[model samples]
Target: MPIIRVTSLSEPGLEVYGSLTERQLKSFYDDLGGLFIAESPKVIKVALDAGYEPVSVLCEEKHIEGDAKDIIRRSGDIPVYIGERDLLASLTGYTLTRGVLCAMRRKPTVSIADVCRDAHRVAVINGVVDNTNIGAIFRSAAALGIDAVVVTSNSCDPLNRRSVRVSMGTVFLVPWTWSDDYQQELNALGFKTVAMALTDKSVAIDDERLKAENKLAIIMGTEGDGLPQYAIDAADYVARIPMSYNVDSLNVAAASAVAFWELRNR
Candidate 1:
C-alpha cells in the first residue's frame, strides 16, 4: 500500500476529505456519480465488506498501528494518507470524531425497481434534508427489518460523511436508491403506499389494515414541513404515530423508528 505521510494540508490528494464540496466529491468531475467519504474504522470496514471500492484512506498517525491498521491492509494498495491529530483536524476544518476516513467510490445506483424487487417493506424518504435524520432512519430501518429504502431526489444524501458515520455504516447494509417520482414508482412496482402525515384522513400507524398489505412502502416527509400535499395525496393510505402529552408529532427520524417497528412485516 502507498503509505504517504502528508506534509501539508494542501497536499495534492487531500482534497477529497475536506476541501471539496459534497457535490464535487459525489461527481468528482466524472460521469460515474462520484465518491463518498466513509468516516471511522467501523463504518469504513462496513463499506469495504459491502464491496464498495476504496479510492483512498485518510487517518491519524496514532491509529496507523491501532484503529486504522487493518483498514490499510484490507483496502489493498490504495493511497493511505497519514497525518498527526492536529493536522488532520485542520484538514477537515474541525476536530472530527473517530480518527479515520475512507473515500470510497460511489457505485452506480440501482433502479428503484431493482432495489425494491423482493422487498416486502420499504421506506420512501421524501424531502428530508437532515443528514443525521437520514442516517438515523436507515439505522432503524436496518435494525427493524425494513426490506429496502427509497430516497427522494430532494432528500439528503444518505452516504454523506456525517450520515454514514452516524449510521455506524448501516447505510451500506441496507439496499437503497434515489427516486424522482417515488409515489408513482412505488405504485408501479405494486407497493401499497403509506404516507406518514398529519392529515385528518390519516390512519394510525399500527392500523391492522396497513399490516395486511403484501408490499408496503412507508413514505416519510421532510424535517419541517413534513411530506408535501401531492405526496400524501398519491399514497394509498395516510398514517400518523399516535402521540402522548399533546406532542403533535415526532421528528422524522424518531417517527420512522416507531413506524418501522410497528408496521414491520410479521
Candidate 2:
C-alpha cells in the first residue's frame, strides 16, 4: 500500500485532496479517466459498493481504524493515508466535514444514441451550472424515469465532488453523454426536441405533445436568462409549466423535479 505523506501544500497527492481549482482537478481526473473525489466515508463506501475503483484514500488518523477501515478492506490493498487532524487540514487546504475522502475512477461515457436507443423519454441539460442543481436533477431524473441525461459541453462538471455527494452517486448510475452539438443528432434520432422556455409561442407543459410522443428529449436551460434563444429556436416544441401569478418560475432543480415527475410515463 502506498503511504502518502501530507507534508506540504504542493504535494501531488495532497493536491488531489482539495487545494486544486475545480478545473485543474477535473483535468487531472480526466487524464485518469475522469476519476472523482468521493468525500465522506459514506459516499466513498457507496461508490465502492456500486463497483467504482478506489485509487487512494485520505483520512484523519482517528478514522483509520473506524470509518476508513471498511473502505480499505473493500479497496483491496490500495493506499490509505492517515494524517493528524491539523495535517489533514493542511493537506486538503480546508477542514473536511466527513473526515474521509476516496478518489475513484469515473465510469465510461456512453453515446447519446446509445443511452437513448431504448429510452422513450430523456432529459437534455443545456447549461445548468449549479452543482447542487445538477446533483438534484440527476436524483430526480433517476427517480422520475428519465432514461438518460444529455449534457452540454459548457455545463458544470457532473463529477464535481459536491455534485456527486449531493447526487448520492446517482451521477455514476445514470447514463449520460456530453454534446457540444446535439441538435442535428437528436433530430436524426427521431426525438421530439422540447425546450422548457417561456416565450410567445411556447406551449403549456401539459400539452398533449409531451404525452403523445414516443421519443422525447426535454431540454432545460441555465438558471439565469433561461434557455438561449438559439436553443428555443432549435426545439420543435417550446414548453412551460403553468404557474400561479406573481410567481414566474421555480429553481432549476425544483423545476426539473416537477418536469420529470410529469413527463415520466406520461
Candidate 3:
C-alpha cells in the first residue's frame, strides 16, 4: 500500500535489493532474523504462503499493474518501490525477470530432529555448494516423495536467491533443516543411512534391500569430490546408480532424482 516511486539507486530501503551483498542481506537484522530477497511473483507467493514476513518489494513500474499487481496486493502495506526497467536493472545489476523482487525475513532455523521427525525417507544434502544443483535436488526431492531434506553445515544455503528461484520455490514446500552431525542424528532416529557413492562394496541403488528399509536417509555429496570417506564409512549402505555407455555417475541433482524415485517407499 506504501507505493514509492524509486528515482535513484541510492534511495532508502532499496538496499536489500540493490546494495547489500548476500552475506550482508543474510545478517541484515541478525537479532530479529536475517532477510532474503525473493524474485518473481510465483516464488514470492510460495514464500509468503510458507509464512515468511515481507520486508519490502522492488519492481519495475509496468509490473506495478501487470505481473506484480497481485503480489503488491498480497503484500499488505509493505513498502513497494517502483521504477522504470532501466533504472531498476541498473540498481539490481541485472534485468528483473518477472519484473518483481521481494525481501522477506528468514524464518528461525529448524533442527534436524524436527525435520526428520516423521519422515520415512529423507535426503541429506552434503557439501554441494552449487546453488543450481541444490535447487534442482530440492525440486526433485519434493516431486519424488522424499519426506524431508537435511543439509549439512558446508552445503549451500537452500534459501540462496538463485537456489530459491531454481527450485521453483519447492524449497518452501519441503521441510528442511541444517545439521552439524547428520550421521549421528539420522542414526539416533533409526534411519538407515544410504550414501550415494561408488565404492567396491557399494550396492546397486535399485537393490531390493534398500527399498525394503522402513526408514532411510539418502546422502548426496559434493559435485566433484563426491562423499568423503568418513561419510561413506558412516553410512549403513553405500549405493550407486548403475551406469551404461561407460558413464560412471550422474550429476548430484540427476542422481538424487534417480535415487529418490528408485528407493521411494511403496
Root-mean-square deviation (CA) per prediction:
1.0, 2.0, 0.9
Residue 19 deviation, candidate 3, in Å? Answer: 1.8
RMSD of candidate 2 to the true fold?
2.0
Per-residue lDDT tens digits for candidate 3, residues 162-197, read 999999999999999998699999889999999999
Pick by TM-score: 1 or 2, better one: 1
Q: In model 2, which range of ten residues has the least summed lDDT?
A: 5-14
Alpha carbon lDDT of each predicted model: 0.90, 0.82, 0.92
What would the TM-score be for candidate 2 when compared with the true structure?
A: 0.91
- Residue pairs with backbone atoms closer than 3 Å in model 3 (clashes): none
How good is model 1 by TM-score?
0.97
Ranking by TM-score: 3, 1, 2
- The runs of at least 3 residues in candidate 1 whose Cα sits more than 4 Å from the true structure, single-residue gaps closed, are none
lDDT agreement of model 1 with the native: 0.90
Summarize candidate 2's per-residue lDDT along 69-169 as a digit string, tens digits: 88888888777777777888876666776788887787677677887788877888899989999999998898888888999988888888889889887
